[model samples]
Target: MAETDAAPSIALPPRQTDGWQMLAAIERVLEAERDQLALWVPVGFGAGIAGWFALPGPTGWIGLGIAAAGVGLAALLFGGTSRLGRAVTIFALAMLLGLVAIWTKADWVAAPRIDRPKVVALTGIVEAAEPRPATATIRLLIAPDTGNGLPPRVRINVDAEDLPAPPPAGSRVAVRARLLPPAPPMVPGGYDFARVAWFERIGATGRALDPPVIVAPDGGSSLADIRTRLTAHIEASIKDAGEGGIAASFVTGDQGGIPEDDNEALRRAGLAHLLSVSGLHVTAVVGAVMLLTIRLLALSRRLALHAPLPLIAAGAGALAGIGYTLLTGSEVPTVRSCIAALLVLGGIALGREAITLRLVAAGALIVLVFWPEALAGPSFQLSFAAIAALVAFHEHPKVAAFAARRDEGIVLGGARILLMLLASGVVIEAALSPIALFHFHKAGLYGAAANIVAIPLTTFVVMPAEAIALALDLVGLGAPIWWLVGKALGLLLWIAHVVADAPGSVANLPSMPRGAFALMATGGLWIVLWRTRLRRWGVVPLAMGAIWSLLTPPPDILVTGDGRHVAVRDGRDGIAILRDRAGDYVRDVLGEASGVEGEAPALELMPFARCSADLCAVDVSGGGRTIRLLATRSRDFVDIRAMTRACAAADIVVSDRRLPRTCHPRWLKADAPFLRSTGGLAIRIGSGEVESVAEQVGLHPWGSFAAGSR
Candidate 1:
């Protein structure tokens, strides 16, 4: 042995080269993580779609064209020869395809834009009718009369003093109303209602001057008509307004009928997801159907012996999912669930196991490719986040070991399932917390506990009963089932109320910057998608995001788009609202953003504010700088004089009235023209900086109608 070692003590070619070794290592890593890398393809593509939407004006088109050319050149040069080069080509191609898909869809669905506000006669079929608590606030969807050069659809608020009944869908209606383009966000970084309306194809919104006349009676039953009828049936069976409204929402997705108090309670309790027909409900329906069908088929010896049980069950599940989606109006979430269900069923039919991550990602890609705008919506974001987190956690060896354990005893199995549910809820709550805070400025503190109680009741008892009732009603035998469904819903509502009434149930956090959310999402995805120990690095960015959120300061001042209300931050970090009238959406947004529950009582109670009937003045001092603001809507000459004097002493003057020529340079006028142009305003006192939603988001197709008016 010693002689053999001496013989082999020759040069061994310097251990291949570091560069070649590194390349080989990288190749191995790519081979090992090919599936993991494939999942990120859709993520990058979605980001590209969102980027196109975020770009200002026509710049997106130029960027898209460049990406397309780059993709083509990259494909030609590499063609999958080199792993690194292939990755670059794939990314370039995804970005290019995303831009192309969005551009094409946007053009195809583009509707006539409203240029000005005017009274017009609208005559079209009533696509939907939502009856509000106040009879006068009924919402009507009127398809625009063809060749009117109006948008394809217009949402009108009907003011009917006395009506026998609400207008049913499928009825032709005529109304005379003053139509105006949808309003923009009420403050900087606020919710963009106009953007939502644009995607809905609602070109304008208006208040009907008089009751809408039914030009023609209901002609035929459409999906909307069926939903309306089902909603009415559920409401009639329940008898209690709150419970019935909730029941109808679960059954038909008609949440407009729910009482405001009930809606708020559900949201505060973190049970709002139950009211929406999302992935949970869809999964529940499909699973229940599959289980029941399999059991029934097992009872039939001839069929069970001859047929493929898994394929049959999957087919039944797919059918149930499709039914639920159609019955629920085929919303974005419902559509996403249907896609996932179909993909899973297809896998089963092809004798392959369904991978949760791939299924979830495939569903998302399908939805985004068809409806690119949905990529920006909260439903899409939250749904995908929840599923991804669930899949990631469940895929872990520890979690899988726990889930795989079986207990033949019913009690022990029940306990195990409960524990698993609690664990899943915790994971989902953690994953969605930042997103909820960013989008809604609040997160339910007890969401995990609330979901533990609500999910089982909604999934096992309530939704199944609802599905059965709908089917029974097809044969005119649904009343008893509907009654039972109503009782189950009552219990659910009671749980919601109790949970929502708990102290500190909702955490009101200031809205974090978009960049912080990007960081958080990246870290979360990194941890979920990577298989190596390097995944631990994700905690660094996540922790950094949390720190950034904690350190970020709330806006110093918030001005409503209408210019009639303003909220200033007080010394106690509470919001001091200076308004003669209640600021509806604007007030709520500011209250949540400032972490204040209610409005500050008076100017004297405020940190730096003094007010009179004619004018209100605020002075904020921070970071060795002072910002003085004077705001008023009073038209009285004395009030105007007082405002002018205050303006002379202030750094920023806001008013609906015209400012004197001398004060023009320092004034931030909130006249009709200004409000129409800027939407809303946010001010930073320390830096004396101001931002408007219009300027921050810029003019895009969603806001094009309002921009056109400007």
Candidate 2:
């Protein structure tokens, strides 16, 4: 309406809004990120090609053909496709190749791995255990018992009979058993336990149920004896400090002295990861070392304010981290942490301002290329996912806005530390949740709360105190350090107990299928690695897969029996009965185990009654009644019969154990405790687990595994 409304020329500014800039920034990152798919393609081809020969039987030929097809397809795409087309094609093919390799490898599983059950002569060192009478796991280096070439080392799950007195980690022992590679679970999508054990250089695993017939012939001079002596010395020093055994475990991953109840409490609380001696622990050391090194550098004028000094400190931190990894015996988690750390350090050295997702992919590729079996391992999956998330997408401006607003202290120094920890936890825990749910079926709600205090305390106090105590012991000033160490240990134990006992402490979820987990993981990768927002939204596919499982249609082939009993019913809560403890494993395939992956299942451990009522809140199935029991138990205890009949009026009778002579009910003893239904995979949600605690009891028998104990 004014003078020039129609004719005024409007100035068109450049389309460079903050959002555009961010999009552009993302594009630049995509461009700068070297084509990891290109790399992954070649690596996959090689593994498939070479492994073709190493792999057993006809599947190798099938794999070879797939490799050829992939190569041909890759070439055609390279010759004619656009940049986007080629990148997408390469990624697709590489992923497909990886999937094929996974399935093919599963086919390669073999039985009768160890030569025979025997009492053979062997020599090796015990890799670890707290020195106290309560807990320890000893590894023995195995040889022909008379060979010049190095002998393969094996880890033996030792027990009370292995030694007159319990030994610390690294004690050399001579013992024997029927040694064989542990068998992976026979069920589809179950954990590949044996293969993982193999990667850690263990050829055979068996119980050290009986002690060596004789002590070392040359006690002081033998290498095994020497290691034992050194380990014992450390043990004595720790004992002298008068700290209870829990501290010993935190620092050493040896749970020899912790009471079983305390261990159980910690496991329930989700605070058990503190004792694992993995990345978290290494990071604590790194934090302390970095602080010390930076302070030292600051004292020297030449070092102060120099970017090079910071770089050097990072490098030094890497070395220290590696040393710890070695001392900790190169556990899978530690190895992954060390590898990831160095790669990050290298990026820093190269003057890189950003960490690309490709770096994470590259690191994972390197580890997998060498240890392909690790693809199935928990550490490998969890570590890489967490690292990938942290390295690339952990803190986006969008996600971090809330965080910034919450920080009222001007990003003060302490606040910065807290922020770093919280962010790291969110990234890593989110990345691990699906897998954890798939595996153990429970989530640790209190993990963050526990770690908030645990991380800082370990970083500033516990770790440093440990180092000081160790250093002092080398001289003669260990007593005071011991007292401090004891206090720290007590703090950790108390934290474990408190966290474990929290209400809503352990919610159970269901176990998800492996395929579903892989889909979710791929979705995360797509989200992080793809530059285009629309493409990244491919996470919707994974999310959909997860949700689909939550609404999994109930199964049709319901086996409500152990070996002895069989009852078929519509898949619903309180459906099956197991007789023998061994039967639980089998039952799990057909039904839910003790719930807690995501949406808790209703499976219970056997040899008890009133199971279904305890597992579910509402009976989805109409009330129908079935009761099965062993005659002996029925006659001996009227309570047993009453309890069986009261399985919330379940309409099934499957007896896997010996059927009651009068009841004549068919039952199965094997039950599935490893799975969940109607949702996600059940993970070992809390810190420590019953299995870990049970294993520890062999070394430290102070606690109870008494009958009917939880």
Each prediction's TM-score against the native?
0.90, 0.66
Compose the digit string of candidate 2's lDDT tens values, residues 1-710.
55755776688966788966875575555566545445445344334533432343445556665665676476566533444445545654654455456545544542223433444556655444334444444444443233412225554555544554545434446665546544443322344455554444444666655665433333334333433454455456566332344555545555555566676666566566665666667777665677778788889886685557777778788888887776665667777667766776777778784356666666666665555666655666666666667765544555555445443565575676676677676666666677666665555666666777766777678778877877888888877877777677667667877877777866554445545665686677666655445445767877976886565432212332112322122233334432233354445443333341122122343223334422211122222323232211122333556534533243223222332334322322222221111111111212211121112112111112222111
Clash tally for model 2 = 69
True lDDT of residue 456, candidate 1: 84
Per residue, candidate 1 scores C-alpha lDDT tens digits across 397-430 of 8889888877579888888889998899989988
Alpha-carbon local distance difference test for all models: 0.76, 0.51
Model 1 stretches with alpha carbons more than 4 Å out = 1-26, 64-80, 133-136, 147-149, 159-163, 407-412, 470-480, 599-607, 622-624, 637-643, 664-675, 704-710
Worst 10 residues of 2 by lDDT: 674-683
Give candidate 2 misplaced runs (Cα > 4 Å). Answer: 1-68, 71-81, 92-112, 115-141, 144-158, 161-183, 186-191, 197-204, 214-264, 297-315, 354-356, 393-395, 399-424, 553-592, 596-710
